[model samples]
Target: MATSNLDLADIQATVLRYRPEPYYGTHVLLRIDDARGGREFLRRLVPHVASAADWWLRDDAWIAVTLSYAGLVALGTPEQSLRSFPASFREGMAARAEHLVDVGLNGPQNWEPPFGSSQVHVALSIFSGDQLKWRQAVETAWAQFRDLRGVTLLMSQDFGAQPGDRNSLGYKDTIGQPAIEGSGVEPLPGQGRPIKAGEFVLGYPGETGVVLTMPQPDLLGRNGTYVGLRKYQSRVGAFNRFLRENANTAEERELLAAKLMGRWRSGAPLTLAPERDDPAIGADPRRNNDFDYANDAHGYQVPFGAHMRRMNPRDTRLAQLTDVNLHRIIRRSTTYGAPYDPDALSERDDEIPRGLYFIALSAKLMDTFEFLQREWINKGDFMTLGRERDPTVGLQENDAVFTIPKHPVRRRIHGIETFNVLRGGEYLFMPSLSALRWLANLGG
Candidate 1:
């Protein structure tokens, strides 16, 4: 089940669904099942995929398949699962690969499972309303897969979001997206930032164990990129209130949200038309990633402190931007738990604590995840002055007291408070489709 190139139409034809990638969104993961005789089991399953598109469907749509030390006990026959596979198995399918664990490496036979090892976690992106049906299909499929040992499912949908939505926040999600200028994925324009060959696929000679390198080169073509999955919570109510109280004018409030977010809610990027909404420009594929911040001298038009500006500054020199943003993740976050009910908007006490199940693919986590959290999002004044805290999901250094400047140019401090908290997250290196198959049948 390997193909050189999988067009969107063909992918849609097979999955019977399609979702054009977005800058910010949700990814839903369903824990399906696990098998113990890992490599052997996967070896037998790979050929059964039937087509290359099926492999891509699994690779792009499925999240990481994390195995644990406790997996041996869960295999039901610890002794059998503990037995070592031939060296050829290591050579042919597992040399220099990270996390290619032996049965008893972490602990002797008597030990329990490691922190997250007892089960194999399988995840899928929540594309649309059809996800419920898709989840059911995935559950049935895994249960029926012969190699999987015992299957149990847990729905993980609660997660957080990046700052700035259309309504009140001064932002839009994924401000500067790279248009494939010459067929390859060049993260964005202004700086010939072409997504390198090794960036997305694996099994290439130099790419083994490299987190940013692509995993499945033989199966996926040159442009195919790997996605990462994460979940985060957003304090929409608190964020909305902050803008209402802080902003001097409705226009300023709207501008701030758009600036911080990188786009107007109408999906327009502040880089192109910073002042007002431009529906046509935002929607135009040819023009969206065409602008740069060099034109804005004072950081007023598109604030230097703006999340989009700081994250993707569009410069080879002087920008001091990290190489991470080049591995641009297409965030597919969606609100989970309970829908934002119009009636609940006015409630004195929220009946349910809600958030997002964040998901996206990146060549490396540091480039995408850590940088966004530690540098761009967490740093109170990212690229400019008076822009401390994202007001929605951004972390405040201290809960005791806080303030944000009125304008990116003014630096006038305004009182603020802590908003959201990051409850939990894990850095999972989602393996290529072949890697998953190799993992499933380890000993068998």
Candidate 2:
């Protein structure tokens, strides 16, 4: 099916669209004290929730609303309907800690307030490219909930976030969100054939040529999708220190950075411009994400264990080759905290609280998002690298080390500490506009 047949107007915009032209973002978690007020909150916010219509157009701002399992219960969803969701989502991010490798410093016990707690029921997010438009949209959402006594704001993170698609780590990101089969936007260079709509939106046929079970009472699940919200605190100082310890000259440090990531800081893929930083190619959307790893099988240009290469591994032969598209998730990641401060380290090793607000969208969170964190990010057996994790964002073992493939000999860089710490995370279900109404009218 093409873009025309898809129910664009019913699906939430965040599911298919990137909230694009990205510049700023906000994440607000809410607690529902009463079922009636929770339903009313959804009712009032329904009109404002963005739809996936004309996804390519440049919207100044967009609002997104999603509910946790607790949020659904607070709205009084039928128990049978509640059981319809996957155990992964029903259990939520904190409960599935061991499976997600959220241990040690990244444990849920250390998570920011209300993130892993059941107190957080609803999630509201606002993204804008314009300040004035962003404020209006945020105020509009606040107006919806402020008057309700049963609804209370739990926490809000990310304001005036980093712009131009650059992450706090200083490398360019948001480069590889897969294209959906019927998302209407023209597929960019590296976004292989658009993924099946069912792979993303609920109630559609996936790549397996089957529709995975949707939540009961079709109104609740159709046109909806699961979301995994993660707040990462980037250890910029540690990251900077790692580079300095590994290399001597500025040029060598940059090359190591490129080797760690699969791209230059400018978003240029190392596969395309291996020897030096190519600002022109990095800035060009057409060419930046187009190249594949097939040509550099040995990972001489792009290390096999590089962050992007591990997350994507485009055209690279895997020991167990599975359809890469099956594991793809749409990432609308945004950066937060003070702009990338190089000197952000304190004597206590307490780095600045700045990192990416990782928003992942997929119909099958277990198969796509969870699987990536498990097999692709935390382990390297699939890539034929024993016990090696993703060098950039993966959970690193205490004695973790990174290996860079070179011509004569491989360069092994040790002290590969975790750069991105999981401050908190949660699983949410973003309902379609119609589903929001269905929720609003429930038990009314």
Candidate 3:
């Protein structure tokens, strides 16, 4: 049987659109007050929601909305309808609260906020090239709920900076994302294969050659996806201190940082340019993500437990696993707070906040996002590297150590302090464009 074509008009733009034209974004977390009022708010907001078809035509700005599992129920979705959604979404991030702590998600208790808590309901994402324009749009949207008394804005974060792509640790970030088969974006050279669209979008065939069972009533499930949003607080002082302690010269420190991340600060991968940083390769999209772990299987070039390797491991041989593509996900991250200055670390008396707002998208939350966190990131046994964790983002204890395999003998770095601290986050369901309309009409 022939598969049907994807309805771009029915899909949300964020599900397929990789980059939003180098724009600034603001994420607003909302709590629904009244069911009827909330539905009315959705009714008013649906027309402004961007669709997959709008990605090509628009160049200036866009907006998208996703509902938490609680948000769906608050909008008057039936209990039976809610049951069809994934357990991860329905249970929220609190369900995995314990494991999250084990993986360094435990930050200051007061900073937890209402994100993964019961208070959070809806998420509104606005993107625009002009910061003023995006802020105006957000204010206009917030006005609709003000009079209705239907929704309350829980928290908001403004993301993106001038020349706005670098993360807090100051590396050229947002590279190495896989292209979906039908997303109109071509895969970078050496990206292996275009990931199955169904892996990230509903109503499509995934890596397992299955369409992934969707919720009944096509409007609600087709073209929908799931998201995991996390805020990481970067410890610049600790990172600089680690490098100073580990390496003697500035050159060695740079090399050590590159090995730890599997990529140079210029965004170049070590697998391709193991000897030194190559600005030319990092600048070229064709050459950047082209290399895999097949040639450097022993972790000589790129360490086995590097952040990039643990996250993807593309083409790397795993025990009893032929294809690791099933675990791939699309990441859309933005840095928060000001850039950190290593030289001023000692004199900086006050607490200066800076890190990343990490956003990950996938069709199945458990198989892709959660699995990567638990198996690959938090643990290292699968990669044949004993108890060592990811050097870049892993939860580092006093005994934490990272091994860099060399021809003669491996080099080990010990007492690696955790640099990225999790502050707040949540699991949300980004529904289809048609589903947004359905939600608006519900209980009317």
Which candidate should be chosen as best, given TM-score against the real structure?
A: 2
Winner of 2 and 3 under lDDT: 2
lDDT of 1 by residue, 1-444 (tens): 122322322111112111323212233333333444334433443443222233223213322233222332243323433233122211211121122121222112322222133232333332322344445434433544344444444443422232323222223333343322222222444434544323333222212333333322323212223333333344555555555666678777666556555667666777678669887876565666677666665566665555565556564133344454354554444444443332232323232455554444443433445456555555644343333655445555444222322353355434443344333333333344444443454455
TM-score (all chains, Cα) for each model: 0.62, 0.97, 0.93
lDDT of 3 at 197: 87
- Model 2 whole-model lDDT (C-alpha atoms): 0.84
> Which one wins by TM-score: 1 or 2?
2
Stretches > 4 Å off in candidate 1: 1-34, 37-120, 126-149, 156-175, 178-192, 203-228, 248-250, 316-330, 337-353, 366-368, 380-392, 398-409, 416-420
Runs off by more than 4 Å, candidate 3: 1-4, 20-22, 56-59, 99-111, 162-164, 320-322, 344-351
What does candidate 2's lDDT look like per residue over 199-238, in tens digits?
8899899999999899988988999999998999888888
Instruction: Report the C-alpha displacement of residue 28, candidate 1, in angstroms.
Output: 6.3
Error of 2 at 238 (Å): 0.7
Give the C-alpha miss distance for residue 213 in model 3, angstroms. Answer: 2.2
The model with the greater TM-score, 2 or 3, is 2
Error of 3 at 266 (Å): 1.2
